[model samples]
Target: MMLLALALLQAAATPSDAATEARYERCIDLATTNPVAARSEAGKWQLANGGWFAHQCLGMAYATEGGWSAAAVEFEAAARAAEVAKDKRAAQYWAQAGNAWLAGGANDKASAALNSALSAGTLTGLQLGEAHLDRARVLYATGDLDGARRDLDAALAVVPEDPLAWLLSATLARRAGDLPRARKDIAEAESRTKEAPEVQLEKGNIAAASGDEAGARAAWGIAAVGKGAAAESATRALAQFYAK
Candidate 1:
């Protein structure tokens, strides 16, 4: 173990200061359309000892491919490397690790990793908001409705403009039988953003929860603006929900 540690320590890293800048160039190129390739490319730096940057670039790559498992590994590695390097802002990597774990089907582990991330510091308001969003998603998936709601509310309190936070909050509100809150949040999101098919999808979700098929259809039509995969899924959900 000591030998491996030494090797990890001595390994010719890709240089911390420059790794992020370089990886971002690669990430933007591959992630826009070729996610799988992007992931494989990003994974190359895992053993390079580049700290949080390598992990972040790689995390985006895996997220693009929906390969949460791989993303979790990279993010976890980044967190450890950052901690060892005493990078005070390493909390972001830890948060990414937790999010990846949650996305990868490791619930308890995700929470634990996130706690480690939070230990780093309160970080910026945006970072705190993201932490709450991640925790809420994990808890909601684990069937902890109350916990999810708490996190969502905290996230909204910090950064209400965060689309994902609003969408998740609205979902949880609908689940908690707070249709008015759900509709309000969804409407607020729609009013604030013209892009992001997800905003429309969540609005459709709100309509479906209210059993308003026409409303749901109208919301989905707005979502189909980009005619992307997200839009298709929203259309499919509306179809299925309204068919009943």
Candidate 2:
């Protein structure tokens, strides 16, 4: 989601004219409001030599339509084009490609793209932190827990205010059997957002692991109030707890 948000914010590469800038802006707006139209507009622009900006918009359009693999291809193409032009935005495009790949469940491709982005060392601040976080997610999915932990630590160091980073770090800690770390990280996540079901679920897990059945039950109850995967998982956890 963050990556998608970033894509929406992308500006054209110092457009040669105001008209080009306006066109790019319009295409990006269409990407969010009407992805099908955006795709057609971007395709036309690309045929007219819109370069990396056109590819980037096309990627955003695909992403908005939930076409993750197509989005990744377009983003990677944009990154390559930017690189050929010696543009600093190439790193950002690579990061976007990695996010799309991750969304498509292609962890290997995600890892490679993210590695390219980070290795460039052009990203900074929140962008840098998010790139690390995305790579961590890929690593976690691929069962490279230690590598994921390292990347999560890097992300937390750069973006301590991000609740998702804290939540994921807490989840990883709990999975690694580091209850104390889990509790600490989850508390940080809770401070940022007390009502998130995922945070509450992690809290329940950490509490359960610490042998506090009542605390776990209460947290899971809070988690179960919502609908979706987290709530379903909380319900299952509650069922198991009751059985015990």
For model 2, how does the per-residue alpha-carbon lDDT over 140-174 read when each residue is reduced to its tens digit? 88899999999999999998988888988998999
Q: Any residue pairs clashing in model 1, and if so which? A: none
Alpha carbon lDDT at 43, candidate 2: 98
- TM-score of each predicted structure versus truth: 0.67, 0.93
Error of 2 at 220 (Å): 0.8
- Candidate 1 lDDT (Cα, 0 to 1): 0.70
| Cα shift from native, residue 198, model 1 (Å) | 4.2
Candidate 1: segments with Cα more than 4 A from true spot: 1-66, 194-198, 208-214, 220-244
Question: Using lDDT as the measure, which candidate wins?
Answer: 2
Please list the C-alpha lDDT of all candidates, in the order they appear.
Answer: 0.70, 0.87
Cα lDDT of model 1 by residue, 1-244, tens digit: 0000110111112334575766656654675468778666666765665456656667666766777777677777777877787875467777777877776779898888877876777456766777777787789988999999998888889878766777777778888889999998877666667466877777887888898988888878778665667688776776675578
TM-score of 1: 0.67
Q: How much RMSD separates candidate 1 from the native structure?
A: 8.6
Per-residue error at 159 for model 1, in Å?
2.0
